[model samples]
Target chain A: MRGAILHAPGDVRFETRDDPEIIDNTDAIIRMSATCVCGSDLWDYRGINPVSEPAPIGHEYVGVVEAVGSEVTTIRPGQFVIGSFFASDGTCPHCQAGYQTSCQHREFVGAGGAQAEALRVPLADGTLVATPEIPSDELLPSLLAASDVLGTGWYAAVAAGVQPGSTVAVVGDGAVGLLGVLAAKQLGAERIIAMSRHEPRQRLAREFGASDIVTERGDEGVARIMDLTRGVGADAVLECVGTPESMQQALRSTRPGGGVGIVGVPHGVSIDGEQLFYSHVRVQGGPAPVRRFLPELVELILNGEINPGKVFDLDLPLSEVAEGYAAMDERRAIKTLLRP
Target chain B: MRGAILHAPGDVRFETRDDPEIIDNTDAIIRMSATCVCGSDLWDYRGINPVSEPAPIGHEYVGVVEAVGSEVTTIRPGQFVIGSFFASDGTCPHCQAGYQTSCQHREFVGAGGAQAEALRVPLADGTLVATPEIPSDELLPSLLAASDVLGTGWYAAVAAGVQPGSTVAVVGDGAVGLLGVLAAKQLGAERIIAMSRHEPRQRLAREFGASDIVTERGDEGVARIMDLTRGVGADAVLECVGTPESMQQALRSTRPGGGVGIVGVPHGVSIDGEQLFYSHVRVQGGPAPVRRFLPELVELILNGEINPGKVFDLDLPLSEVAEGYAAMDERRAIKTLLRP
Candidate 1:
């Protein structure tokens, strides 16, 4: 089987590798039907995050289970399924409380390499949620999104405490940010503010139910949000970019008693204690327990209540994974879907 | 009027100042019956927080209203009252959302200085909560505690989402931290874990409903908390310390989905974004909106449901203000009360 591996910075190669096998009694082998490039992946491709050694990459996938370990009872072979980036034993206390990312027994699926012809997923019974059936190619992109980005965006909205009649500010224009707009809309936000200078993304944000768009960045961005919010700031803010500026904006653009949910993979974000303490905003985020929202998101996607798959503007064959990475890194694509 | 004046670091002199009159239309003058030295006062005394010039130095007090401006209708002269360190209109959006400390027109009462014989309070209609009647000396300590420390502690518990059957961990054992334990108990926390090494403070914490006292510092403290919670951490954590280590400990001590409320005046606290992003802990706090809880807290104190005033271990005359500061700085007293 062939899988994507990073030999070094700016290098992604799809080469032959031994097929994965079920290792743990609760593990299963999944043949990938679809995978994609995540925003975090650009970190390594751009040399911002150093790749110490050649390793398997990518963590999002929607596929068919090929084989399952004897101990896997809920999931079986030949079933179509979606898997979260982190494999969780759903029975753990944290998982029971809807924080699967912090599950007592958890594994990063990327370590097993999901961007391959086949992948090994641990904790199969609790990690993989079987779909109604093998989805059509048209439904594949949206289903695959539920594996990470869509569910992540959903988690961000939920974490920020978005509810009916709430006002939300989204601070990023990536796929996750767009999906966050969709999620906020689905969650019944009365006003959704998308902070974006890019015209294309701005259009998509409006289509996703954004009531307002601000082209400012930094202090100007916060000012625009304050202006639009009658100087009270948004009721909730979704921080989909994890830079220092984004974090600060998220904190500052929220009403004193509001909430900020950060889903971006933070690289160098450092928050001043005095600022956070005085801001009076509730801040919460993490790896995003995507599995916790997968079932509901899957149902929503199947019912056509949302079209998060619209984020994937570019599609490429598995052999063109390098171009997919480059396209996203260079802003040529919001998201790139890969067919295996 | 004689007030505590910080002429310079290590130089606190009792000096005379002009008697304050209602300057703002919303202002009121109060005759101080009692005030206290706060932990943060020592910062300027130790030169950590510079005292640029001679400045009045105290923020917490309970007293009798002496005079009021024409605009002050809700409160009148001769009413015994408890006031928060910060004055808020209580009609602002932030105040309406229960975060009065971040009120748009909020005023720090210390600027008018409560350590004097008579003090001027701004936003009188919203800042001063009248007592049922003149509080006895016994109730004075508790009501004065409500002016800041107890109110701050109560905010910490509320922000940490303390509820019935919840297990809470409190970091810091100063007057505020010990009071936090009391607040958690009042909020019905089932098991309260207090991290403190001071024997006297520890005793007060236990008396305030700390079920367990872990006399460990830093990692050891986190380990103790984890060991007690079966390695999952407490359901809620109260961070009463403003240092970086305390912030990290608070983040680490809470369960993945738990909440942390930090009220310490964060001087040099800087939080690592990646650390907080991956931690998945909900963090909320600030200079507590003491007025938001003042009325309810006063009712509880008057009804003898709780006794947070016990945190004040040393009482001194207004002339002994310097000694009061020294006693807390040398760790000789948990809190110091001054009668003017």
Candidate 2:
């Protein structure tokens, strides 16, 4: 088998690797049909997150089950499935509460790396949700998105308390942020303001149902949101960028008694308790419990109610994995879809 | 008129001052029936919050309307009323959304000092909630409690998402925290855990509906809460202490997908963004939208359904204001009620 491995900063290589196998009775081997470069992956690729040694990359995938261990039930070989970055036991208290990412017996699915031709997924019955059928080639990208970005964006919107008639603001313009605009719209938000400086991303944001666009950053962005919402601020704000500035913008852009949903992987962010206390805003965020939303998101994708796959602007063969990383790193692609 | 003034840390004096009068068309002058020393007041008395100059102190009070400005409506001069520390225009968007503390046209009711015989209240119709009738002296203390502490505690429980059968933990055992236990009980929480080291406060907490008392502080406190909940953590946590330690304890005590409602005025508290992000806990805190809950709280107090005023273990005349501050500052009294 071959997979993408990060040897060091800016060094992703498509190299031969040991084939994935079922090591536990609850595990299953997946023959991946598609995988992609994630915005989070750029952390290690840019040396912001130290890559101590060569390691497999990628956590998002749409695949067909190649084999299942003896104890696995409800999921079988030949089935097409989408799973979250974290494999959770569906029966755990946290999982039952819809926080699968915090499941007591959870495992990071990216440990073996979904960027490979095949991958091992633990807690198969709990982690993977099968599609109604093997999806069409055109539906592949959207199904792949449900594995992470789409689910994450949807979680961000839900966590922000977006509802019918809510005025929403998204603090990042990345793939997840653009999808967040889509999620807010699906949640019936009456207005969505996307903060972006890029031309192409702005166009995609508008297409994804952003009612307004603000090309500012930091205080200016918050001020623009307040201005647009008649100085009351948005009812909900989605924080898709994990920086201190973006978090502050999201917090400040929400109306009193409103919510700020954070989906970004925080880097060096710190919040002043006093400021948060006085803001009268509710905040809830974490690694998206993608598993909780997978089934519904898959249904929506298959039914053509949503087209989250539009985030994939650059598609390439799996062998060109390094090029995919570079494209996203250089801002040449919103997201890169790689065919296995 | 004479009122309590903080000349400096530990220096409180009952001195003569100009009588309060209606300053705005929406203002009303109230002859105070009762005022109490709050845990928050000790911050200034202890010098944790600096007293730049001699300033009128006190923000909790229940009183009789002495006079009403020309434009005041819905309230009469002879009515008994309870008001929050912050006066808000009920017509503001934030107020309409049940976050009156963040009302755009807000006034600090404490600025003129609530400890005096007469105090001016801004946005009279928006800020003051009249009782059904003028009650006997026995109801004064309870009505005063609703003006701040009880309302704050109720807001904490509500913000923490307390619901039927919820397991709730309170992080402070002051008047507010003790009442938070009562609030949790009123909200139908099945288990109320009060965190306190003081025996007297602990007894009051139990009396207020705390099913369990944990004397641990900091990390040990969180560990005990987890142990009590069988390692799953409480469904809701009330943070009634503003220190960083208390905030951390509240956050760590809540289960993933749970809520932490904070009411304490935060001091020098900074939360690590990554820690909060991974916790999967929803946090909502502020000064508390007390005005939003005033009516219901007053009704509850009047009906004898709750006795939050029991927090005032020490009672004194208005002239002995200095002793009231000292008793609370030295922890000799849970709270002090001052009569005019």
Candidate 3:
């Protein structure tokens, strides 16, 4: 087997690796059908997140189960399935509350790296949700997206409280933010403002149901959103970029009594308690509990209700995984889909 | 008119002042029936919130409408009224959204000093909620409590998403926190944990419907709450204290996907974004939108469904307003009620 490993900044290598196998009774090994480069992956690829040692990297995938541990139930070999980056024991109190990412018995499924020919997923019965059938080739990308980005964007919109007649603002131009625009639209938001500086991303955002696009950043972006909303600010704002400035913009662009759903992993963000208190805004963010929405999102994708696969602008063979990483890191691709 | 003024830390003086008069078209002058010392006042009294000069103090009151400006409507002279500390034009978008405290056309109603014999309340038609009829003397304290503390506590519980059978933890034991216990109970929270070290406040909390009391602070307090909830943490946590420690305690005490409602006017609180991001807890805070809850709270008090006034443990005439402040500052009283 081969997989992508990050050895240092600007260095991703696709090299031979040991084949994945069931490590526990709850584990299942899946032969990867599709995988992709994630925006979060760039965190380590850029050295912003230190790489103390070479490690397998990707965490998003859709695959066919190749084998299952003796105790694995519900998920069987020969089925096509998707799972979140985090493997959760679905019966935990946190998982029961629909926050599988915070489950008491959780494991980072990315530890074995989904960028490989095959990967081992723990708590298989709880983590993986199989499609009704093996999805067609054209539906592959969207199904893979259900493993992370699409579900994440959906969670962001739901967490932001986007509802019928809601005015929503998304503060990032990445795949997640664009999908957030789609999610908000699906959730019945009446108006969606996408803040983006890139032409291609802006176009995709508009196609994904962004009613307006603001080619500005920081304070200027907030002002534009406020101006567009007639100074009341949006009913919900999605913070898809994990920087302090992006978070602030998202927070400030929301109306009093509105919500800000942050899906970005904060790098160096600190919120002043007084400012938040006085803003009268509600904030909820975390690693998206993608598992909670996997079934519905998979259904939506299969029914052709959504086309999240549009986010994959670049595709390559799994052997060219390093190039895929470079394409996304260099802004040459919104996201890269790799066929394994 | 006479009012209490803070000239410096620990220096509250009762002295003659100009009579409050209607200044805005929406203004109404009210003759104070009762005003109380608030925990927030101690911030200034303790010099934590700097006092630049001698300023009229107090923001909570139950009073009789004495006069109204030419354009004032809805409220009539001689009506017994209860209003929030922040006056709001009821027609503003924020007010319509039930966040009157964040209303665009907001005014600090306490500018004229609610501790005085007379107060000029702006946005009279919006801010003041009149009782069904002139209440007997006994209901004065409860009505006054609705002006701020009770309303704040109620907002905390409401914002924290308290629902039937919820496990709620209140992180403060002052007047507002004590009343938060009452609010949680009224909201149908099955298990209420009141954090307090003071025996008197603890007793009051139990009376207010605290099912359990944890006499610990900071980390230990969080541990106690976690232990009580079988390590799952409370479903909703009310943060009625404005300090960073209290905020952290409240955040730490909530289970994933739960909520923390904060009503305290934060002085020096900052939330670490990464910590909050990973916690999967929703946090919403601000000055209580007391005006939104005024009518309902007033009815509850009038019907004797709740008795929040029990927080006022000491009483004094307007002339001894200084002693009232001193007693609250010295912790001799949970709260002090002043009569004019």
Flag clash pairs in model 2.
Answer: none
lDDT of 1 by residue, A49-113 (tens): 98899988899999999999999999989999998999999998899989999999999998977
Off by over 4 Å in 1: none
TM-score of chain B of 1: 0.98
TM-score of each: 0.98, 0.99, 0.99
DockQ: the better of candidates 1 and 2:
2
Would you list the clashing residue pairs of candidate 1? none
Model 3 vs. true fold: TM: 0.99
Model 3: how far is A157 from its true place, Å? 0.7
> What CAPRI class is candidate 1?
high
Instruction: Compute the DockQ of candidate 3.
Output: 0.94
Q: Candidate 2: deviation at residue A10, Å?
A: 0.4
Local accuracy by lDDT, each model: 0.91, 0.94, 0.93
The number of clashing residue pairs in each candidate reads 0, 0, 0
- Can you write out model 2's per-residue Cα lDDT over A190-299, one digit (the tens) per residue? 99999999999999999999989999887888888989999999999999999999999999999999999999999999999999999999999999999999888988
Q: How would you encode candidate 3's per-residue C-alpha lDDT over A171-240 as one tens digit per residue?
A: 9999999999999999999999999999999999999999999988778888888899889999999999
Per-candidate TM-score, first chain only? 0.99, 0.99, 0.99
lDDT of 2 at B285: 96
Pairs in steric clash, model 3: none
DockQ, all candidates in order: 0.84, 0.93, 0.94
